[model samples]
Target: MNTITRLFDFPYHQLEKYNLSDSLVTKYGNDWIKTSTEEYLDKANAISRSLVRLGVNKDDKIALISSSNRTEWHICDIGILQTGAQNVPIYPTITSEDYEYILNHSESIYCFISDSEVFEKINAIRKNVPTLKEIYSFNEVEGCKNWKELLTLGEDKDNQNIVEERKNSIATTDLATIIYTSGTTGRPKGVMLTHQNIVSDVLMSAVRVPLRAGDTRALSFLPICHIFERMLIYLYQYYGISIYFAESIEKISDNLKEVHPHVMSVVPRLLEKVYDKIYAKGDALTGIKKKLFFWALALGMDYKPYGENGAWYEFKLKIARKLIFSKWQEGLGGELELLVCGSAALQTRLSKVFCAANIPVMEGYGLTETSPVISVNDMRNGGFRVGSVGKVIDGVKVKIAEDGEILCQGPNVMIGYYKDETQTNDVIKDGYFHTGDIGEIDQDGFLKITDRKKEMFKTSGGKYIAPQVLENTFKQSRFIDQIMVIGDGEKMPAAFIQPNFDFLKEWGSRKKIAIGSTNKEIVSNEKVISRIQEEVDASNANFGNWEKIKRFELTPDIWSIEAGHLTPTMKLKRKIIKEIYKDLYHKIYS
Candidate 1:
């Protein structure tokens, strides 16, 4: 196999060549409904041919703005690529303002929207976006050339040459996709990744945990707009893996059980929520079940670190898995080989607990600028490390800078943020792409991320505090679901916490507090705040005095994507949180 391929080159060709899809029929059956490989190639060729008919040429930007649906998304994406045009994907959840900004900023001439909602959204702002020349819809909507209709126009004999010529025009270093990340900072900046960047990442990641012909079921729910999931999509195809598109975020668990996937790429917040759900269920268990649940977790947490081959605590874990955690496994469909987590730092305790439960949760690290994956814990091949994001994959080089910021140099690193030369220069220096995160490599070469260099804050007492470390400690409390540590130039460290309402609501009922109170009133209650204060104080004991959270305020609402406190990838935008709840922090210190 060639070690590298151009983005415009057909990746699905490799799948067919390898004959790995033969067993896919047996594994997925009719549920694996995708635009078949032949159809995909035909559709892609047709679309590329049509784009040529429309006078689209190499390097012309084509934007795909839609939700993650299997067929239309691929048709447009492959179409755009096969035409030698750069594909820009926008999350359907983005606002009208952001949509307009990306359309004009990328200077996209051709755009494919999913449904009428997207059509209406763009149409409402189209008059203002001069760069947008045409709008195509996936479904037949009023006043638009449907996607299939556009492809039909390219049936001329000469169109095949257009597809071939377009493919040949693409180079490995040419821009493949421009993913816009609305990071914690101001407006979103376009992260430009080339064909070599992501394809290399996908192949390299496969080395750490080889994707075999039999081991190939995946539940695709994470937004392909994000690099982590996007890279996996190509990697799955590269490995001839059969992917099952999840219906939506709401149906992931059901989809997981139905797909019974061998592997999944997830974010830490999802894992944390799953752990909380299991813990909540355990809390409901009676007598023996309840005793067994805590006992297993305690054993996992207290057990000495065992390398991959060692099973010092396996005897206790085996009993625990059989008696208590087996039902939990059943809930996840029992066929999960590994769960990979990244996009944010996972609490070490939570990682420790899940791995102990025999559900191997391999935590990793990366940023959007780095083609989104720098390091991930090796699933079962290399000896696993509990607290780190495993070893760097082959072909990727990582080094800690003087101040602990992770610097990366690899084929996977983005070509730099699109069109923002000044800002791009600030981040990508020399050959290394500076990931604004801070971390240190352990003696074993596993990367343990401490905090974001940009997010680390100082208190008025002249003490530097890494809020992520403190926040991770607080997540262990089980009562505090999400917290934003804010002590930047303040007298002492204080925090705005979003309590686990499910846990609190249950606690409230047991204590006979009013059941129907608003979340704000519930969290603000003297008793509830005092209880959480004890949790903070307990968490503080584990950290150095300067790093401890001294005082905190609880918020009624959870920090979420819709709430704007968290990014879509589940990373907390601390500045946004602090700005949103400035009064709460002020009141706490006052």
Candidate 2:
């Protein structure tokens, strides 16, 4: 087979070549379930054959709705692909409206769900979807067909020939998946990616971040439905690496300790939480221990990735590594060699600190339209940049537009937004996909993101303010949890702040301050407001007077996915936040 064809069909080839036993590990309740490569392939093949029997044709769309990461997710994904069908993955946390929109838009024929809860979710709106033919559940349900029954449907000898013919018929340019982008603005767009788009990315990324089969153990916690984690799964399979699915978001710490994985993928939000937990522990320490903890953290924060510090600084860092950061390593399973952070910009301070503590955080940049990875930090390639998203990967060409928007041209770019020619034309023009993000390419070829072109807003004084810049800066403060900087057509930049409640309560206790019973009372307290003001002032010191936040309102409520304030990826939904806090915004400016 040609290189492109081989790349497109590598997953199935790997399954056929690898041994049958003990290849994949999945977490089930308190136990780990091990499945051999052959076993996995058999199940996936059976599902593919069954799908064919159900009249699923090439280019047919299949929707999968699941919450937890399990072996069945991978099995069904591969199965769908084997039948030359496209997979439409939906986040389990998405709204019912989203479910209806995606199912109808994609014109999915078969729906596979994880459990009864997900089944019920689909069942509620099943009548609305005209194209959907059958519903299958990974777990046994009252009304849905069990996934295991698909194997029986494919038990006939003729099914094997059908499977081989289906696999052979698939071309590298054929549409592999129709991933709906969870856009922050307007309706979600379905990004259509071909086999070549994803396969090229998988291969290119593998070169940057090398992994060995049987040697590297990966702990998967990020949503598999998301392209970032989904792409990593294919990369892991390509190298024959063993993957352990994390039980849930809450169990990540415990799972890390148990798995002792060499590498893992994460979003910036998770890293922020981890840092908070670490700082909390340090704050809990007393006397000399507390002093040392703060000292080490300060040293970490000031660390530079590329430049050299003096011998004295290096000596102290060694001591900190041995004394303070060693325990941090242990808490993370003690074997974490690399952490691939994407989905959002990681704070430069956090990245530096973690690296100084001997944990390398490799930050990358991409959107759903680019088959996800356009650039990433490669430790072996001198591509590590502290504040920048590393050098653009091989086979991808990145250039800055006159307005500073990053434009990319590569094989990895999606064909088009599914059935939306106008939208497709808006982004992909002259073979370059406009990334909407304003960024600059440094002398070293590293990409430094400044702000989003669409997100920058001007105040009444005509001074433009980038809310993300201020929000990122303010979040560095231990007192702040989540913040949104708002000032479009206003006098000065103002903010709606969510204080780190746990940290605030601890501070209140230490100071013997009386925090009232209600959330509103606590947030509106003079002491609480004063403390948050100090934090805002500290963050504002780095900016100009016009850019500084003049006034702010404290919100006791946390922004979350269910509450519609955050996207599934944990990015703040600015429009939603504005609408929800319309009165609060007026109050801040008033």
Candidate 3:
């Protein structure tokens, strides 16, 4: 068995061990295409040979931008790395201006895009990038160079030796890829990660995921440009789990049913949406069905693992699982044994309820610089904890700083920020990477993240409030879809919220209340405001008086990545959201 030290080595090792027939699957039109391990390696090698013919050199940077996850991206990732070149994966939803900044900063020489949507963004700024020699499209677009041309060029088999030679010369510690963090504010920084960084993280994170050898399936819809999903892609390959790319974000439910994946990775926001959608269905039920639904939901909310709530409660939960929670499992593909949430803090209620429903959600924590998994909730052993991010994985050491920041030291940490020593030094000190998140490890070794050190703000009274904690607490309201706490230098804390419009409309209809139809009209409804206030008042009991939201205003729009209210990873772009809703911010503060 070959020791897997590099990013490309994962699939090759899978071929030796599992020889999976469906190594990677992507939907084309209405058909799902499967690529075997042998085929995946062959195509990846072809990509390498093709790049060699195109004058690509070791350490040369190439940029890949995709509007959605696809099989080509993984092939290109391996193909690019095998040639000793690093690929830069950028967010497809970012502005052309951001596209120009990252391409220029990384000095990417060749660019590959998934479709015309991503192509248009890049092609608009293609002239501004002096180092970008040519553009290739994975999906054929009008008057664009296609990636197949490279494969065709390499088909002659003449430069195959050169590709192998390049592979042999590449060390395990060599640069693998440059990922531009879709930052909440400022220009994005290219986080340079070595082959070992991701490979080690994948190996360490694998022990946490319970799966059968090469027999299970994974549905990947989260942006592959993000390290969380990308690293999981490699991990899926390492586990011999067949990888299926959801057609689009809109089609995840349909794809989930079609593939019936055994495992999936989701962000906290998506899980919240799933829970909300499920709750809305239950809300529509009549009579005894409705009564039983709320009964199960109540029991789920108060759930604890390892029968900590005792035998009678556990027996009631088993009845709840059969009566109601089973449908929740069925909705997410009947065999969904696990879902790992990350990129933001998950509500403890969401984790507890979901786990109680028997669909285990292991909320993990890490950043792109750490090759992403610093610590994650595990299902094996007694590692299942409801509130924490679970125990730190083996080989990764986490210690809480005096300021309550999590500082990590491990092989998985990135080499540094690409070409920015000062920024790198700011985060990395004394051989430990400063995580920027305030967290504490429990006596039982589970790690719980409290809040972002930088995101915590102070009031005029000198009281500090952790907005994430407050937001997560309030989001348990089900009425609030999105909330941002704002009170810096103010007399008291307040918030700007995006109400769950779906629930609002249904609730309005159910009560025969005229809350109106449009987002603007609904938010302006006095009754709607009063209803949400009750929820806020209910949630405020969990917080200190200073930490509670004194007042809040509803936003007339949804907070989304495409709307500039959120980063691609679904974290709130607070500064951008503030600017977008300046009028709403003023209304709450005034």
Which candidate's lDDT is highest?
3
- Determine the C-alpha RMSD for candidate 2 after optimal superposition of all C-alphas: 1.8
TM-score for candidate 3, please give it.
0.98
Error of 1 at 465 (Å): 0.7
Candidate 2, residues 1-590, lDDT tens digits: the string is 22535233555555655553555688776788888778787788888888888888988999988888788888888889988899999888877788989999999988989999888889999999999998989888998998888878876657778878988889988899998976545778999988889888888888888566656788988888888888888888777777888888898999999999988998888999999999999989999999999999999988975547888888999999999999999999999888998988889998999999998999999988888999998767577878888989999999999989999999899999888999899999998999999999988899988888888899999998988888999999988999999888888889999888888888888899987767778898998999889999999999999999999998878788779888777888888899999899988877
Clashing residue pairs for model 2: none
Ten-residue region with minimum lDDT total, candidate 3: 181-190
Model 2 accuracy (lDDT, Cα): 0.86
Model 3, span 1-590: residue lDDT tens: 66988888898889999998899999999899999999998988989998998899999999998988999999999999999999999888888999999999989999989988888888888899999988999998997899999888878888889988998898989999999884434878889999999999999998887867789999999999999999999998888999999988898999999999989999999998899889989987999999999999999999998889999999999999999999999899899988989999998889989999999898899999999999988777898788899899999999999999999999999999988888889999999999899999889999999999989989999998899988888888778899999999999999998999988887888799999979999999999999999999998988888888898989888888888998888898888888998897787777
* lDDT score at residue 142, model 1, on the 0-100 scale: 96
Q: Which candidate would rank higher by lDDT, 2 or 3?
A: 3
Candidate 1 ranges with C-alpha deviation above 4 Å: 1-3, 8-10, 18-32, 140-145, 155-157, 183-185, 303-312
Regions of model 3 farther than 4 Å from truth: 182-185
TM-score of 1: 0.93
Sort every candidate by TM-score, greatest first.
3, 2, 1
**Which lDDT value does model 3 have at 288?**
99
Clashes of each: 0, 0, 0
